[model samples]
Target: MTNPRFDVAGIGNAIVDVLTQTDDAFLEREGLAKGAMTLVDEAQAAAVYDKAGPAMECSGGSAANTIAVMARLGAKCAFMGKVKDDAFGRIFGHDIRSLGVHFDTAAAADGPATANCLVLVTPDAQRTMLTYLGASIHLKPADVDLGVIKDARVTYLEGYLWDPEDAKQAFRTAAAAARDAGREVALSL
Candidate 1:
């Protein structure tokens, strides 16, 4: 109803990615499929992390990255995603906020830690990923701020959000709000 407050509002998982370089033989030995994004549980995520070589951590997630890029290009944007109140979670929050995107989703007090994506890049430049959704999967309808969605010119939803029921509901809520407000909605496949 009021003047739009942001150019875009994005909703999806908040993930931290650890990327490392490995050879094709390493991928085969580890039974990792090349260039595939596989979902793994907490234990599996940990095992992959342990087996990975020295890595660099970065804030990553489909919609989250999109919002970050929008902010960097001088587009006002907001993001909604769930994380845990832990170290990696804090890092993710800090990184996004530092990019000047509005991200006000509260962190879980307990439960699993923030999500982690383990990415291994082979010599062929193929990336094999294993993701543990973790606390990011807890994003719910309540986390979607209708006001923000209404105030944004467009509400963007990420395909990965559908992987989690609560996040899927949140995505739908945001899309509905955008529609109700006569705003545009974009869904990334």
Candidate 2:
């Protein structure tokens, strides 16, 4: 095969992170498990957001973060994930693209809002996270770009993506395409 067009192709959730500074009491009051990542529903996520202090929002996700770092390090990278056509979705796409990572997964026209994580940081520097999967969990096999997978030297899969059935199928599809193209498949646990 000809030389690969990209060094890595990453597949995983597309999430916007909202970080806030708070004390341990706040965590206790909110019933949040300090220093742990917990899955929350949309309502729960909103409740935490509403009750949190000043926050900083940014695009972040396991695979997306890895791809962003790789791109900054001069690696040609691509990312595949699902997001809704909402404000957070726009932010995620724009941020990743600005980092020189190719991200062309179509945003869902009608679905739950874009995924988000509420990160509460205590004085101790420990972070407690509440994540709402939302649209990110809607990634289906069709969302996986076979060409991107085949043209990347490595296809990276995020462990969290396996929780959703559709995303799992998409992950499998990407892995199969990479294997078929004689490329390596890497998983981040």
Candidate 3:
């Protein structure tokens, strides 16, 4: 029998998307590999932003995105991630909480800026992401809120979270907690 305190939990990179419509030539000029997520530093990320046309910002992180969709359906959710003390970071924080999801990770006072991904939707709707992991790299096992994991019936994680050691460990921590509580774990592709 499930404890049933909550419906679900999720974990993934805490990222914001800066979307831009671009051409293949632009990708070639920027030396970016098409349809792939390449890691870039703050300087490179800024440079790309400058080259890209007017962009729209949105709260998105793999696990967070899944949680967002679930929340839309009136399901309860929780998340774990790291952000900075900057404006974008605050925006990410508020949006998640406003949706009634619990986010308990502390912000890194001085590190890479909040994780931002440049999502390029080509004319064909093909999406290529260039990401700067930023403070999200700081999310560790300690950030995994075990109490929430124990309460939820289904805990969803993103496979891409494996890209970060800390996030991977955080998922492991959450997974362990879920198993201990006899809950189900699902990895979103």
List TM-scores for all candidates, in order: 0.91, 0.94, 0.85
Which residue pairs overlap in candidate 3's backbone? none
Question: Candidate 3 overall Cα lDDT vs. reference?
Answer: 0.85
User: Can you write out model 2's per-residue Cα lDDT over 1-189, one digit (the tens) per residue?
Assistant: 879999999999899999999999999998878899999998999998999999988889999999999999999999998999999999999999999999999999997989999999999999999999899989999999999999999999999889888888898899999999999999999
Report the poorest 10 consecutive residues by lDDT, candidate 3: 1-10
Error of 2 at 45 (Å): 0.4
Off by over 4 Å in 1: none
- 93-178: candidate 1 lDDT, tens digit per residue: 99999999999998999999899999999888889999998999899999888989999999999887787777888888888889
lDDT of each: 0.91, 0.94, 0.85
Candidate 3's C-alpha runs over 4 A off are: 23-25, 33-36, 122-126
Ranking by TM-score: 2, 1, 3
List clash counts for every candidate, in order. Answer: 0, 0, 0
Residue pairs with backbone atoms closer than 3 Å in model 1 (clashes): none
- Error (Å) of candidate 2 at residue 9 is 0.3
Query: In TM-score terms, which candidate is top?
Result: 2
Worst 10 residues of 1 by lDDT: 160-169
Look at candidate 1 and tell me the lDDT of residue 31.
88
Over 1-189, each residue of candidate 3 has an lDDT whose tens digit, in order, gives 655666888877889888999988888899888899888998999899899988888889878988988888898778877889887788889888888887777877887799999998789877788889888777788878888899999988878777777788888889999999899999987
